[model samples]
Target chain A: MKLLLIITGACLILSFIGDRRKTALGLKKGAMMFLKILPTILTVIIVVSILLYLVPEQKIAGWFGEESGFDGYMAAALVGSISLIQGFIAFPMAGVLVQSGVSYPVIAIFITTLLMVGIMTMPVEARYFGWRMALIRNSLAFVFALVVGVFMGFLWNLF
Target chain B: MRFIKKHGVNIGIIVAFSLFAGYSVYTDYLPGLEILKGNFRTFITELISMLPLMFILIGLFDVWLPKEKVQKHIGAGSGIKGSLLVALLAFMQAGPLYAAFPVAYTLWKKGCSRFNIFIYLGAFSTLKIPMLMFEIGFLGVKFSLLRIVLTMPAVIAIAFIMDRYYAKKSFEIKSLQ
Candidate 1:
């Protein structure tokens, strides 16, 4: 947040000094864009909150552990792909799972899919980037997450 | 009426939330209300903190940065340097994945190569520095480092595949612009 503030402050200062007209225009454009996307933003936030509420974390963790094997990775990836938990909450929770003996690869897949594929944010993504790009990108991310998970498992074993 | 029509989805969601809240109240289910309130509060706080700066940055890019310059650097045939620059920029960003969408749209409209845009989005999702730090803190150095190393190549490959696939289709960039 401080970084954002610092950057924004710097940009504002620079814009004011460099070109006052552009500064005004930028602010206006920014506000306009904000308004334009406000509905989508609201929908996404509400949907994510509801999803997090419904899907109990313990249940999600229960679906993936060291002994769960290939099925466990797939389940983790599926859950991660759909859920929209924030990184702050997710990382700490994942950390606890790791300590509790969940396979690192499963955790990795969970994190990868959680970040890369956003089923909940699909509407927002499609709104911006089109349905084709949104769908293709997400599908590819899902595949990559699986591949990466397997590789991470091998790497973990090697070391 | 036009505004309502345009925001129909959002309104629908709001109505759903209200009905849920009403039902919770009727049933004396206090926990549901508590969850709703807490979730809403968190969402609003996140929005307040992130959206303004993101929109402002997008505006600044739109108003200040010349399309030609952006195109020259990251457009088709921009090579490895363009990819690296975008990857670095994505890594520096500190926000949720959705926050990257507007900026990516602006870049796409400005004629950034499809490959680089995908790379940018991929990097934004998983390679954020702050996120990496958090991962390291929780998952340890080896785990975080391995994921980072592995993800870079995976992201690039996905970008290439996406660019190739989309190029064949009449994927018009003009509609959004």
Candidate 2:
């Protein structure tokens, strides 16, 4: 993030050197866009924070890990889609679960849905892609996440 | 009244959460609040460091990069080359999926095809370089490699489905402003 900010600042200076008015115009436009998106972004952030607080990540693995069947993949998929936690956190938690004997396919479903499908962020997505499009995209992701999981089961032959 | 209406949901969320947080503190309940604080710290860090820069970069993209350039590369006819480029762009990015939204929107506005946009989103979510490295560190290369192999085709399939689904539907990206 610091790197990104520094690069942006450097770019701004370069743009200023090239054309002051255009640089000003770009800044104004960006600020406006930022303000416009702020509310929805904040709302999503709060909702997600509260959710993580309430559910906790530990409980999520147990939802499907013990099942080791069709139902297990479904449960993991559902948990993952709903949680939508960051990869930084999710991957480590998943790694711990894997070490603890959670099936590879279950972890696959969990990780895929967690990353690809976001039930919580659908409103934000709908804001850009429209409700129907968001629904279709997420549905497709959900199905494919499951498919990915099933394929993992076959590839690993662990479950 | 108009302003409140405009931001009603966000205001409601903040006010309600604040009250709840205060009550939690007064009542000696702080686990949730503590978690919230941690999450907020992370969120604010990203907000401060990445988002504003992202917005301005998007602005620069808007001001400088022409629609024809985006279209010629990632639009309907760009095909496999476009998909590879989009994947590379997604791999280079280091932010969360939501941060990619505006960038994707900018690309869309600049004439990127629906297919490439979906590819960009999927690839951004899963194929990012730093995140991939982190995943490998945690999950091991074999597991991570299998995941990438499994996910790539799925992403492309979904992208194909999304493109075909939206191929006929006339739609507009809702303006938040």
Candidate 3:
């Protein structure tokens, strides 16, 4: 954590030193942009946090816990596929979910597929990569996500 | 009408994405489904917050970094540097790829190679700095770092495998006489 902070601090310092005026201008611009987007982000976080507070983690974990078997894995994948979350949001979300007792495997599936196979982002991918490529890529990604989940589950069980 | 014609596909795509997202938000069936509404709220907020910073960064990149320099670094001969470059770019970039279309298109038209473009697209899924920061803070650096490292090989492997097989296949099928 300290290392990460130091790296960020160094980068900031370097950028500041490299071009103070430009960096200041960029920071100002970024601040304005962030302010514009802040409300929506906060609202979503509040809603999700509310849901987190309301839902029973035990119930969720019981259903999709490591002991839940194949059913659990499938449920995880389905949830991930349906969510269509961007990668940025997915990891932290998965982390919180895992901390709440959701299986590591399940969280792994959620994170991998969150970016790999995007049902919501399909058309865009298709436009760029071709439908065949997109479909194949997403399918492969889905398969890999499952693989990742299973692997993580095994690791957790082993370690 | 002209505007519609120009943006027809994009508008359709945005609406379709919204509907699908809305459906999930409304369903609230899964364990986390109820969080959908909140996720939506935060998602838009983050997007708004990051968009300008990103644009400015893009502008800085545009101004300071020479296209040829970027191209060479990410292009065919770059090897691991290229992959790292892709990962860094992906880590730095925000927004879905759809939103990145104009930028990608512009770069492509500006003589960026197909290989680099593919790397960038692949990187799109992997590198997300702000998200990583949040995850590290919330989940612990080890978890985030492990996942990031684990994913690095996976993404790069996929890119390379696709590069070797799919790239050629697409070219053959499309450009054949």
Candidate 4:
């Protein structure tokens, strides 16, 4: 966050020096973009955070815990696809799971899906690229996330 | 009526959430209101921190980035160098994936190839530098590195696949743009 602030600040200064009018135009565009995106961002936050807060970590771990079978991995992927689990929460949770002996593939599936497959954002994305493309991207992303996870896990075992 | 029409989706969601939350709390099955408070705080904090700066950056780039330059760097047939550049762009970004969409759209307008656009989105999903650093701290360097190595190929492969699909269809991005 600090880094982003510094970079944006520097760019704002450079932009001001380069052309005040364009900088003002940029600010206006920025404001417009923010307003346009507000609803979708809020929608995602409401759905994802609510779903996240609904379930206890222990309950989640129980269902998708280290001791869980393949079902746990599948369940985690589905949840990750639908939800936005912030890195702050997800990475630490994953670290804990790792220490607890959850296999690499399980964590891999979870993290990859969380990053690559966002069902919540599909409506907005589809607005730009069309539903067919959005659907293809997401479903393909889902398969690739799992593929990457399993591949990473296999490589980890090899070494 | 005007206000409701403008805010329909958002209002609808809030109403649904309110009903669900109220029932969950009333039934004593969930701490819906409590969770909503906690989650809302997080939502606000994250939104405030990310949106303003990110949108400004996108706006600035949109204004400043030359079309010829964008095309020369990442347009069709730019190949490996283009992929690397797109990846670097994605790495610099830090926030939710939703935040990257507008930037990607801008790039598309600037004539970035469909393949490179896909690469940018794919890389943004997983290669964020700050996030990677944090992940490494928690998951170990080896684990983090392996995941990146494994994930990059998959991302590229999918980008290639999607690019082909888009190109073959002569996907009319203009319809929406």
- Point to the candidate with the largest DockQ: 1
Error of 4 at B89 (Å): 0.3
**TM-score of every candidate relative to the true structure:** 0.60, 0.59, 0.66, 0.60
Q: Could you give candidate 2's per-residue lDDT for residues A114-141 as a string of tens digits?
A: 8888899999988987889889888999
> Of the candidates shown, which would achieve the greatest lDDT relative to the real structure?
1
The C-alpha stretches of model 1 lying farther than 4 A from their native spots are A1-63, B1-77, B172-177
For DockQ, candidate 3 versus 4, the one ahead is: 4
Against the reference, the lDDT scores of all candidates come to: 0.77, 0.74, 0.59, 0.74
Residue-by-residue lDDT tens digits, candidate 3, B12-69: 6555545655676677556345454454455445444444444344334333443345
B51 Cα displacement, candidate 2 (Å): 24
C-alpha DockQ for predicted model 4: 0.36
Error of 4 at B90 (Å): 0.5
Give the Å error, residue B90, model 1: 0.5
Candidate 3 Cα misplacement greater than 4 A, ranges: A1-18, A156-159, B1-88, B99-118, B164-168, B172-177
lDDT of 1 by residue, B54-170 (tens): 567767766786444543454443568877877767776656798888777766776667778888899898776545545765677789988888888899899989889988776
- Those runs of model 2 whose alpha carbons end farther than 4 Å from true positions after fitting are A1-67, B1-77
lDDT of 4 by residue, A132-154 (tens): 98899899889988887668756
Model 1: colliding residue pairs:
none
Every model: Cα RMSD to truth: 8.3, 8.8, 8.6, 8.1
Clash pairs, model 2 backbone: none
The clash count for each model shown is: 0, 0, 11, 0
